[model samples]
Target: MRFISRTSSDGVTEQLFILGEIPGVLWTPEDAAGARPLILMGHGGGQHKKAPGIVARARRFVTEGGFAVVAVDAPNHGDRPKTEEFAEVVARLRAGMAAGEDVAPHLATMHTFLAGHAVPEWQAVLTAVQELDVVGAGPVGYFGMSMGCGLGVPFVAAEPRVRAAVLGLLGVDGLAEAAARVTVPVRFLLQWDDDKVPRAQGLALFDALGSADKTLHANPGDHGEIPEFETGSSLRFFARHLG
Candidate 1:
């Protein structure tokens, strides 16, 4: 891993780095040391590693939970060059959406393609991040929603280092098998009236999880309207399982 820059503010430190072909950011408490629990955050579709939500949550996790948080741009996202095949898939999705068609299938296809690359990318990032002195090998947790959840289900299932996860805002279409493979503690958030992801599909995804210790937190809102209090609940959930 090669660090590109480092900045500090408000008791938190942010470091940007390049690992192989991936560009990512890591956040931790300023002057942090020793092994601390690490949280890997995944941003929604079309969003980059340092999206407003990802940065806010990463800083909060670093300052409040005393944990190291990391985020990376998915393939064909942010600083990465887009592939022709990926562009074709996205065009189909956009056309489907504009036609007011059932875009779930298109979304599933996209997630499947992305997960093929993202899962291994996340595993490699985790391996590299844990090698750092300030963020040693330790219990890890994942926090992702929407497209993040779609991609995360496979990563959490395939990676043994992840001890817990906060996932939701996605459906069970192309992810049920992976969801069934995840046995770690999970806190799945569902938006009661999500326009992008149907309520029933979201509930189905939660039900498909194989974890014996999993909780579903549902609230009345759209896809982007998750209640703010859920963030506090997520911190507590990670504390319970990852600490």
Candidate 2:
């Protein structure tokens, strides 16, 4: 995405276009100082870069938390080609329900999609930011909600540059290895009543992580609650570690 335009308060008015084969908007303040921490946000399923409230959250990071934000619309979501075949697969998985089980195949497909598209896009974005000397190329933070978190963990572990993590909404997977390898602080917020996300998965991830500074917070909410059940707590985690 290339910088296009911006004019928000707290110096967060600059907009850039992320020129991917898949494009997106990078709305960040023009700050050369890498002193500010960053949050690279991954989009949720069926949502895009222009999805509701993402920019507002980005603005909050800029105006209040003193962080730069980078958010992307994941593949097949938000400004990308809608792959109905993928949706049909999800429906099939839903139809074949089992005891103590929900939709796992859908999530598995999500992992596959992110591995191929979103993660690479994020890596490219991080590289681009470094090349531009944007915000002085400081350490970054990762915040992935829902399937976003599933993608974020592996990215955090693989990138080696991400300094902190907020695994929002989504429980955990592929985190143990990352946690053991990463010195970065990690915080997980698992909502109690999340229908789509299995609770045990989160617990397993929490137990598996070896990071000394890892934390797991359980609050009441479903998968839909935002900036409240877990997002704000996420901001606070970024503030503490990334700040």
TM-score list, all predictions: 0.99, 0.82
Predicted candidate 2 versus true structure: per-residue lDDT over 15-79, tens digit per residue: 54656655655555645354457678776766767666677677767766777777767766776
Where is model 1 more than 4 Å wrong at Cα? none
Error of 1 at 85 (Å): 0.5
Off by over 4 Å in 2: 9-11, 29-35, 83-101, 172-183, 226-232
> Tens-digit lDDT track for model 1 on 1-243?
999999999999999999999999999999998999999999999999999989988888888889899999988888899999999999999999999998888999999999999999999999999999998988999999999999999999999999999999999999999999999999999999999999899999999999999999999989999998898789989988988
Residue 140 of model 1, lDDT score: 96
Judging by TM-score against the true structure, name the best candidate: 1
Q: After the best TM-score superposition of candidate 2, give how far the Cα of residue 18 lies from its true spot, in angstroms.
A: 2.3
lDDT of each: 0.94, 0.68
RMSD of each: 0.6, 3.2
